[model samples]
Target: MSRPQLESDVRSAYDEVADSYADRFRSIEPEEAIDIAMIEHFGSLLQAPKKVLDAGCGAGRMLPVLAAMNCDVEGVDLSPGMVRRARRDHPSFTTTVASLTDLPFPDSCFDGYFSWYSTIHLPDSELPLVVDEVRRVLRPGGVALLAFQSGTGTRDVSEAYRRHGHDIVLERYNRTADQVAAALSVGGLQEVARLERSAVSPHERDGQAVVIAKV
Candidate 1:
């Protein structure tokens, strides 16, 4: 499928299960301590009163985490329904409906960029463009944190939502830490740190990874 079609499908799938998704993942879970630690490390690397963008911030779950770190955080997601839930759930932060490939922000405006399990929907061929857009919106020395399942190939993740009574088709494309690091490097960002951990939770089907980069 084309990139546009893929994006549309992702948006629609998420929109269909926005409420259930939000209810299930409104906060950080204990199983995600390592992942949350990586995010905290990313927040620590930044200066005070940081301007952060939570790219593809579903339900704005992590917005509070960033805010607690003295960050002036805003969010953007491709799904309007997700954005709406984000705004309703976290009214203090701004959430907009926007695409990762085409962000609605000015150049070099953010001190930090966060994409927590958000890029898993993008195929390998389209990662560079999204990374380039990430580079565009970050200032010199800005930090970026990306969290996703680590592996190779795609998986049908729609069953998770189907179990909650929503029928949606969702495909998640997995990539290695090196693959993501290379994409960031090509987008003018340098890899700063990376962590890959084995899956521990019952819901997890693959290992997870967090890549921290700087522009």
Candidate 2:
């Protein structure tokens, strides 16, 4: 909530290094077995052309997974460069530049929503607006799987990147699982499940939070 610059920082930061980011995250890793399994489960639960939105889908990390699952998926990112790389990398899919706090789609436009490691950049003050936007874009009974780090405060990953000779970026916001669930409920989504896993790296929180909900 402190830095309103985060919104603009995210876009400029990502756009400046989209190519490098895309090259790095063009796909998921093999050691991410558990993570991939969760994604697969979420994708399998939806039918073909069910209309799913990949909220903040940077460089199209979930493109292949969702495509194989047969869900009609589209991606939206705050950085135009990320959108361009995603489209270039996954030509079969459609990608656009849009903000989660203010999505571009019409009301009740999608049947499912997927946001993996995206909202980590949003300040708490902005999280509710995003949740409300998600609710507005979902049809009745529409499902959503949102993921983020589990903890409090924010991490300035940009400094770390700069030290590593990489481009700077925005802070990663952390929140408890309860915080996410309560916000979703207030935004008209009912939490159906909670998934947690120990953080695989020291840079992460004690664990991660993935909340599954439905309208």
Candidate 3:
């Protein structure tokens, strides 16, 4: 599929289920100890007053996590419905509807960046564009934490929403840790650490890979 069309379809699918998505995540978020630990460690890299961006931050889940680390954090997502839910659910937190490939922020604006599993729906061919954009906005010595499903496939996943009765499905891509690292390197990020583990949460069941890098 064309990039623009793929982007539009992905955005619309998430928008269609934004409310339920946020509600489901909020309930299960407390059980995400491993993700939280990694995020907390990422936050510690920047001191108070340094800024952070939660790229593809659906429903502003990372707000309080980063807040506890004493860093200013803002979120952005491509789905407008997701952004609206984020604003409604976390009134104090700032969020906007913006694509990862074309961020609205200036160069070297953030001291750290977090992507979590938000990039799962992005096509592999376009990953480099987003990575370069992330690198462009990161300050020197900044850290970025990226998480993805550890596998290879381009699958359309509309069947999972049957329980919710939403018939919502969209195309998603999976990659190996080496693929992610290579893309980050192409974007000028230096690899620092990596973690691979069994997927303990319901949101994803495939093996998970998390990579830490510095700019």
* Model number with the top TM-score: 1
Worst 10 residues of 2 by lDDT: 24-33
For candidate 1, write residues 113-215 as lDDT tens digits.
Answer: 9999899998888899899899999999899999999999888888878888998988899999999999999898899999999988687899999999999
Question: Please, what are the lDDT tens digits per residue for candidate 3 over residues 50-116?
Answer: 6889888888777767777787889999999999999998888899999999999999989888887
C-alpha RMSD between model 3 and the true structure: 2.2
Give the RMSD in angstroms, all C-alphas superposed, for model 1: 1.6
| lDDT winner, 1 or 2 | 1
Instruction: Give the best candidate by lDDT.
Output: 1
The runs of at least 3 residues in candidate 1 whose Cα sits more than 4 Å from the true structure, single-residue gaps closed, are 1-5
Q: Which residue pairs clash within candidate 1?
A: none
What TM-score, over all chains together, does every model reach? 0.96, 0.91, 0.91
State the C-alpha lDDT per candidate. Answer: 0.90, 0.82, 0.81
lDDT of 2 by residue, 114-173 (tens): 998888877788889999998999888788888888888777778756764666756787
Roughly what TM-score does model 2 have, to 2 decimal places?
0.91
By lDDT: ranked, best first: 1, 2, 3
